[model samples]
Target: MDGRASFRRIAAVLGVSEQTVAHRYRKLRESGAVRVVGRLDPCYLGHAEEWVLRLRCAPSATLAVAKALAQRSDTYRIQLASGGTEISCHMQTSDQRARDTLLLDKLPATRQVTSIEAHQVLRLFRGGPDGWHTPIASLSPEQVTELTPPPPDPVPLDLDDGDRLLLGELAHDGRTHHAALAASTGWHESTVRRRITHLRASGALYFGVDFDEHLLGYSSHTLLWISVNPAALDAAGAALARSPQIAHAAATTGPTNLMATALCSSADALYEFITTQIGSMPGIQTVQTAPVLRIVKRAALL
Candidate 1:
């Protein structure tokens, strides 16, 4: 669903009053059960590279390290996993200097960090603007069509200082009204709206939902580090991306070239998915599963 859609449009599709929809949404947001956030594609920012970092830390220091990483502007999806002994997260760096500063200097110097491994994301088979599709389908085809935004245009958009200001506000709250955006960006409300539309159409910005998956009946979250034959890497990634259990999948530079995050209802359900969906795939050499113990940060900054 388009996060920018008005309450009236959402209520019309759900067969509810706009007031009810608005009230419910506010309640969810205030309770920290759900949030809508605007995310920028790092690729659009020149020289930016995304990496998946795995940090093995002392058991007693894992939470501290994870929390520290979560506070960084460049890190998101921070998780404590492997019996609270490992930390995993996605990091974006604007340039080689930024990358080296962390990967080579900061992380290596951390006393509690016993080891660090960084995998450069080569290709995204899922995640990013595409997002994860819930296994449970609630909307009718007609309603889905009504809510879906149009395909983004292929044109490139260069971000200016004013555009960055607008994005900074949206990053905090995607549903912020145009007047607030205008105040932040120092642009007229009409200009802010037009710029937002242009940014989305250019594929530079997208809105994503951050929610507590457990509240929605999904209790199992596991990360899979998969080693696949180079010959079948693309095919294997595409297959993983098609699985409803996978929220994110990508080809990365590492011993395990393919990585995925699976969300399931229970340990039994996750076992079934691994054995049937992943185990049956061709060219799969090895699979390492890391159950996420806690999420310190999601796709958006907290």
Candidate 2:
């Protein structure tokens, strides 16, 4: 993803000014809809090993455990379960040798770990769903909140097939030329522009993103499955969602009551994050760690 490219480089490549690049970047981030994270080679970053841990705990305890593990600096992520037998966490480290000596040997020893599985990812396939341009007849209040240049009256628009495709094209690549999109969609350039304007006003368009993880030298990735006290999940989930490094957090139907995806610069930083930032939160119970050995597909939409 050219997402990792610096502002000056982006300007040079796109033939734009540094100021324009900076301006666009700001709008993207504040909207909570932009993330240009760096990409990294697990082999190069000393995060060569990938492990998945499944934990069995009380149904009410998933979030507590998930949040506990999420605080560890080594924990790159965590996930919650609604009700399941085992909570799962994905973890990655630099090499097999270290994995055996440190993660496999020492990591589990640090917590009330249940079961663990490890696999090597031969390749990664990140896909973009076809729905970007698949126009939805309506926009929810929360989705509307994610948009910028806020709609004057918070109105949702009625979009046809052409409108959805146009919006999808822009969301996929905000830099897509109106003229080119018009040619492919069989609409006039002006019509395309007006349609975009309407969608933008209605908060149906998203053209902001950030994707710079590996390029920034983050050496480790982890996803934790936590079982928390059931009564405490809603509050706990809301708290975890506010952290910047916590890329994504959701409650799943699986065993892991709570799940959190985290990114950090080094193993030590990851450790600190998990212990201090996460563990310190209220209502936490148990924590498990699973490093992302290979990222099948890590990005979300714009």
Candidate 3:
């Protein structure tokens, strides 16, 4: 109930054995689905430049623009945001030269480009799998999972060394079949299945498809940083979380206190979603939208 996340309390309420809960929780961390990775300092990492790509596209060319951006490994995120322009991505590179080459020179080459601009990050704070370590602009509050306080669920788990190897292989490639995983990880099919179940049950594993919004016709996307009243954040966050358009939301430090990324069917739809949906809230003082041009890297990248 309170923020005191003791295993005993958690397990009791969830109606499962303490060991089961503990094991599953460890698995959640192991799986990339919920990680605790750190956000490196861009300057220290030699990524001193942060650029935002803003685009104005010709009618019905959303797919074309996204495809062009996706071809490069640097394209981190693409989403349809407000207006005719798409917020392609917020990216970081080692220096101005790389920024220019990818964000500037390469953008003009796209035939559908109506306009493009890359804005640099002056001072940035973002977190990755490690919260706040990803990017201030890409911040998305993790789902708050509240386990029902009860006697915990009981599930058997016996993962030996070989079984653990199988888990590692599957964690890297979810689609890998038991047979293939066995061959690669040096485990048998039955052992792989049992271990996989243990990992999933213990929260050490997860599998899902990664969505590339560009392919889904959401041609516009951007990251917005907003300063909202602390007292009002609870209400503000609840409201914004309700919007289907918002892909991610997270809290941050400094003038821009809240960061959110979204994929909209149209720029106007994005505008309405922000201005009408989240903006209508009382505590929101200001909002700055930076359209992403391309993403150089992401926390999800293995």
Candidate 4:
């Protein structure tokens, strides 16, 4: 789904019949094992300020707080932390003041929340659930080139109301028809097509495949908080980024400095990944692991 190829194109590339490709796609979609959704590059869209929040709350209030935050558009990823009393979330907002309201003013007002620690995301090495690499190398380079769409022109940094409306529609369904988008935005289908093309080419948007990892043989999902030597930051981050098991990785403000999310098929597999792949990397100082018990939200979808 990375390229959202047509069944015919994909079949041609894979040397399979179009009917076979169509059948497989239908099954995956029907089983709720996959979904293609559009995502925004927050920095390019003027929502540059981003944060990772870890909240310690009363055990009884954990689900309530997580569900409440998941309902907000500004929040991206929310997970129940390992201990069950803590919740971790990633959020972005256009302005610092608005970010404060979402991260500070709002949570403090909730009686269930006991404490909050917020880390400003410095530079994103990779973004998760949606942006990670896959172990399978399906399409060949030549086939991929044939299926790739023409690049769109860069769009203006400032988005008009209509642009935002179109983005919202894509966030709901990346493959949404142009006619449907036009109906929602009150624009001509041609205009909708132009806007989408521009937004994509400008590096302001991306499409991600969302699904239950279990369908892909991944059952354990965990977050890694690692502190590496200042000189080794780039190396450590790069190593993690290349791992197909890593769903997300970023350098952030705080003692830990680096954060990553990874998935494996089982608890033993997770242990092996941490010890062999992650631990063997250079400049690693301290490592803290938190298994995600439940995912409250992923991407823009609930």
Candidate 5:
């Protein structure tokens, strides 16, 4: 149901009435525990590079720095790491020059941060909110097959301005009604439907389900930085991608070639995963874990 936004289709898959699916979706939405938001494909927006930034700031400047970073258009995810003096953020940008300005020019000038390390993501084994295989709700294979959306297609580097409005609405609510979209885009309901279909087909848009893992009984989340032999990078990334506890993983440049985040039920669970499963995985050279103290921003929304 997380990926399947259509109530009618969900009803068909679950063998429930359409009305029942609609009622349940409404309840879940109103509960403030779950949200389905549309995320723009960075490639479609001309962003070909992604970077993870780790910043160590003075104690008094931690919150101030986080607030500033969270306000940037390129920043997709921002968090305060456990020590309360460190901040971690993920961003995507189109131009290397712009990235340099943020990393080399503007950030250093801020004077609040004591140190900054930027890691360039190389390949995404599993990244983003929807890339992982962990299931908050279980559905049969047949049901999932029926609910799966079509594969993405390539789109132009520059998206149309009108489509941006549609994307904005979808960002807030992936299942925004056609009539509402029409009102926002100044188009007919039919046009809104056609445009959305085209956007999805062109890979300009994607939907992700957002929820608090703590609310789902997973109380701990840890971000991991792992170093691996150059030849074993893919192997390490693929292994983490297969773990049910891993929420996000990617190959990147810098001291650590891979970065991953996992959700666990408790500190002991996180330790077990790191020591037993990950420790046993071949090709892994070193692993460093950082607990997330708070998430300041997620996706494109705060």
Candidate 6:
């Protein structure tokens, strides 16, 4: 879904009045049931590297450690997993210096952290700008086509000060009005609009929806760390990306090269997915399942 899409356009696709669509969206946002957030793909940034970190902490210190990590701008989707002894999160670093400062200096200095595993993300098969499709479908194929945005052009982009300010606001609320964005960037409304167009076209900016998954009957969430033969990594990853159970799948540099998040209706469903869908795949050597005990922070900064 395009978070920046106009209410009128959405209403037309859903066969609802524009005012009704706007009202429902406002209520949802105000109730904290849904949010639209702007996100940047670190892969598209020339100097940035993405990594997934798993930290094993003393059981008593897990929440505190996870909360402290959530306060850092580089970390997102922080979760307490493996029965509250492990912390998992995705992090982005602008350069080697930043990476070392965290992985080498800051994290290792923490006494409660018993172990750390940092896996550099090689390729993202799902999630990021591609987004995840829920197993439960709500729209027809035609409606989905009407709502989908055009593919971004992967062109080089240099962010100006004004563009950064504009992005800072959008990072919190992707659907922020153009006038509000202009105020944040100190640019004219027309200029803000044009800059956004350029940013999205260059693949420097994209939007994502944040909502309560449990409200939609998706109660089981777990992270899968699967070790696969190097020769079959690509095939196994592509297959996982196609699975309806997977919310995000990525290839990373580690003993367990394939990592994915599975969202299902129940623990039984997750077990079925692993034993049937994942177990049936070839070249799978070892599988580790970590149930997410709690979400400390979501993908958005706010």
Top-lDDT candidate index: 1
lDDT of 3 by residue, 207-301 (tens): 43333456456766667777889988666665665566666665644455666776677789888877787778999999888665554334333
What are the lDDT scores of the predictions, listed in order? Answer: 0.89, 0.53, 0.55, 0.81, 0.82, 0.89
Q: Give the poorly placed runs of model 1, Cα more than 4 Å off.
A: 44-46
lDDT of 2: 0.53
Worst 10 residues of 1 by lDDT: 41-50
True-structure lDDT of candidate 4 = 0.81
- Predicted candidate 6 versus true structure: per-residue lDDT over 122-164, tens digit per residue: 9899898988867557788898889888999898778877777
Q: What is the lDDT of residue 13 in candidate 2?
A: 51
Per-candidate total of colliding backbone pairs:
0, 75, 44, 0, 0, 0
For candidate 2, write residues 76-182 as lDDT tens digits. Answer: 32344324434555555555565576446754664544544443332221111101111123544543334323322335356588975775565345656678889
Over 4 Å off, model 2: 1-157, 208-210, 298-302
- By lDDT, the candidates rank as 1, 6, 5, 4, 3, 2
2 or 5: which has the higher lDDT? 5
Ranking by TM-score: 1, 6, 5, 4, 2, 3
* Structural similarity to truth (TM-score) of each candidate: 0.97, 0.50, 0.47, 0.88, 0.88, 0.96
Q: Give one digit per residue, the lDDT tens place, for model 5 in 205-252.
A: 778876666777888888899988889888888998999899889998
**Model 6: per-residue Cα lDDT at residue 294:** 91
Model 6: per-residue Cα lDDT at residue 55:
97
Candidate 1 lDDT over 1-302, as tens digits, reads: 68778999999998999999999999999998889889897656545788999999999999988888888788889998999999998998676777788889988999999999999999999888888867557888888889888877756667789988899889889999999899888899999999999899888889988888998799999999999999999999999999988999999998899999999999999999999889999999999999999999997745
TM-score of 4: 0.88
The candidate 4 region of ten consecutive residues with least summed lDDT is: 128-137
Candidate 3 accuracy as lDDT? 0.55
- By TM-score, is 1 or 2 better? 1
